[model samples]
Target: MIMRQGQQLLLPANPLFIWFSLIVAMMLNMLPVGRIPWMPDFLAVVIVFWSVHQPLRVGVVAAFLFGLAIDVHQASLLGQHALAYTTLSFFAITIHRRLLWFTVPSQALQVLPLFVAAHAIEIAIRMLAGGSYPGPTLLLAPVLEAALWPVVSVLLLLPQRRAPDPDENRPL
Candidate 1:
């Protein structure tokens, strides 16, 4: 939706939408695209977005819990995703205010490091547990997640972005 010059739409952010999107992201992560199971980390992207934009609604605990759910669902090492998500949330919370000052694309650029950090945590966990590297291809997930950031922001904000009033013609 385009806004005329000096026009701004300030729709209230609904907490429900935040929670619903997280659940959907979890389900999407579970879907198999191949035996590789290398889907973009949608949960991380969503958590970071909400943690940055709606900190009160989605926080470290939520990120930890969702990460645990993903861990269990994926049958991976316990607490791996949890640790990564919690750290990611912490970073998001710390950066949220600064993030608000930038445009979405710039925000995504800032967030790219967080996604990489999350993946680094995951890799470190695996290495500590004696699990072999999943290969260089594993690195692609974060890049894809970062690339999807702007798209996610736009889609998630659509509900909150009010369209210009069509009733401008109505009088007085």
Candidate 2:
């Protein structure tokens, strides 16, 4: 993979860090605050982030499992989030290489559609299962998630950005 000029090379992501971030995201989603219609899905954002950045380690299965956890937590349709997240991960993985070629903000713009599709899948499944419209504010969820892309990218990539061994004579 040819990196963009000026792009710092990131170290291999630790498996433990990957799973830890996923758990933290899940915990954030499980918070007691009522599920507001416009609130972004933190787990979805993290899942997509990892799927794009480390597809082999965090793929559709992880997304599906996390989605199921969220489904149970929210007491919504069993497969609603599972299917949505699975689709999101699949798409992110498919485009991961191409997506990495762009700047972070440009990548965010590219991923906006993926977020929209994920939320649309969730809403569609809900409506099919006889749930009422969650109102127009529901549209904000995907937009918010896309807006969070850069922040998520920076924070998650932080650990890998550090020098494995800092030495005055070496620059990496």
Candidate 3:
């Protein structure tokens, strides 16, 4: 089980990067993609990523607040996103340490159930409200989000990844 030099690279955690990533994800969620309401929930994805990596810094409270903001921003059922995100963050925080041991793609597989749980929360909320189901297409959002997890993981991890030692001998 020998690891390569750069494989275990880890850099200091930057709060700025964490907050900025969350804000950016929120903005992306609000982007106008008219008529297509099935856009993946960027906020959820980012929250999952941060919650898993920085659970102490980004916990259930942050997820709740962000979910509220999202609720207000989208003008949807207040607290719906909040509840979903809260639940999602809780699960992420709980399993974060275990997740870190796996590769990004494997991590995504582990998160699939959490994504499904979050979506189920949303559906439950709608059902309780007597709202019509958005159909099976609604379920696709979680799948799409899970698929994008690898990309999100890599992009977020890029800044924190250590560069190869410049003094190391070059292949000759």
Candidate 4:
């Protein structure tokens, strides 16, 4: 069924959009960093927006798969990105409802902390699992990812917040 513009689809969606987005994100990740290897993680930012706005459509499972893809592509420890993606998706999904109430600026505020905490977990897990944890540089992921979050979100139509309601604490 063709969903008209601005209307949310109530039925099962085709996998094309999700798969396309995932591929785009992965491709972006594959780009050479040149010198700044610590630049923002485009895939993580993309998945975070999807998880927040379309939690049912994108979740930890997708993140895990993407993580695996990145791990293989980058030849990192098998589960580094997988662990990071799963943890990031979990955080985004849990607070997604409230995020809708936030304006883009407020959403920025919400995302910054979420990104930091999520990456910290990934860094901690990577350290514990088997590899030598990179020093403080791991913390940079959140800073860079948060900076890119809104830009990534604009790639798609903004997902609807909760259905219209009176007395909502709308974003300021």
Candidate 5:
């Protein structure tokens, strides 16, 4: 893929690193902090990140499976997260190419709507399942996730930023 000017050339992402990061995000989400209404969904953010960065490897299926896991963990309605994550992954994949052209902050702005949509889907699903409203604070989750985008982009891209083989005469 042709890169934008001044964009750092990233090494091919390691499959192991990608999966490990996903697992770590999942574990973070599972932390027993009594799920706050405004708490950002870490797994959702990471899944969207990977979906945008490595769509071929971490697409809708992975999102669905992880969403199922989250649903089971949280004991929410079945497929609530699965459906939301699947949609999120689909949209992330759709925009991945254009998104890469933007700077990190700009990318965050671009993805905010995606995160909002994901949360909205989740809330809609919950309500349809006869669940109580999580309140106005729920609105904060997407914004928090968007705020986290740049940090996640930086950390997850670190492994791919290193030169495969450092050389005295070469600078990548």
Candidate 6:
């Protein structure tokens, strides 16, 4: 019997889209909205997406750059976002393959821990940099980002949607 390889699919896979997503995410972070606690960390979400889909290319270096960009743009702390994002990307690249097996809800659950870890790290970095922030309200980002996992996943996956099937119009 002949062995068959999995069918290859077309995906955005372009570096431009990746960079665009990242920049958009960074802009969102500085939008000055979502002040009531628990705002979605758009940058984190984008990093999570690229980390999972393009782990080979989007690694600690990219994380470092993105984090640094956020740091410079927001003027929070030099390494606060850098440290958090780098740490998250490191872990995300490691478990991304395994995470692919999980459903959206389960993936959201998985993201929670990463989100928390990132938030904790960011807070720590801020403290280390001599900044005191609003207490627990600052922690809201993690939970919100975690809850947003599914939506972000979908958005990030959009450029990779499969070709329509012949029976796509038919209802189940």
Regions more than 4 Å wrong, model 4: 1-15, 34-37, 129-138, 158-172
Q: Write the per-residue lDDT of candidate 6 for residues 5-111, one digit (tens) a residue.
A: 54235455778888898888888888976445467788988898789879987888999998988889777778888989999999999899888767878998987
Most accurate candidate by lDDT: 5
RMSD of each: 3.7, 0.8, 3.2, 7.9, 0.8, 4.7
TM-score of each: 0.88, 0.98, 0.89, 0.74, 0.98, 0.83
lDDT of 1 by residue, 1-172 (tens): 4444554465768888888999999898888775462468999999999999889889999999999998998788999999999999999999998887778889889999999999999989989999898888887888888899999998998888764454677421
- Where's the lowest-lDDT run of ten residues in candidate 2? 1-10
TM-score of 6: 0.83
Q: Over the stretch 1-172, how does candidate 3's per-residue lDDT look in tens digits?
A: 3444556556767899999999999999888775353678889999999999889999999999999998898787999999999999999999988888788889989999999899899879978988778777877888889999999998998887755554557421
lDDT of 2 at 20: 99
lDDT, model 2, position 125: 95
- Clash count of each predicted structure: 0, 0, 0, 0, 0, 0
Q: In model 2, which residue pairs have backbone atoms overlapping below 3 Å? A: none
Tens digits of lDDT, candidate 5, 1-172: 7877888888999999999999999999999999699999999999999999999999999999999999999999989999999999999999999998899999999999999999999999999889889999999999999999999999999999998899989988
Residue 61 C-alpha lDDT in model 2: 93
Error of 6 at 68 (Å): 0.8
Report the poorest 10 consecutive residues by lDDT, candidate 4.
Answer: 157-166
Q: Model 6, stretches more than 4 Å misplaced?
A: 1-12, 34-37, 164-172
Ordered from best to worst lDDT, the candidate numbers read 5, 2, 1, 3, 6, 4
How do the residues 42-109 of candidate 2 rate in per-residue lDDT, one tens digit apiece?
A: 99999999999999999999999999999998999998999999999999999999999989999999
Per residue, candidate 4 scores C-alpha lDDT tens digits across 1-172 of: 3434555433333457766877898898888765253567778888888898779989999999999999899877788789888988998999988887666667877888877776676667766877565667667767877777677666554332334443658421
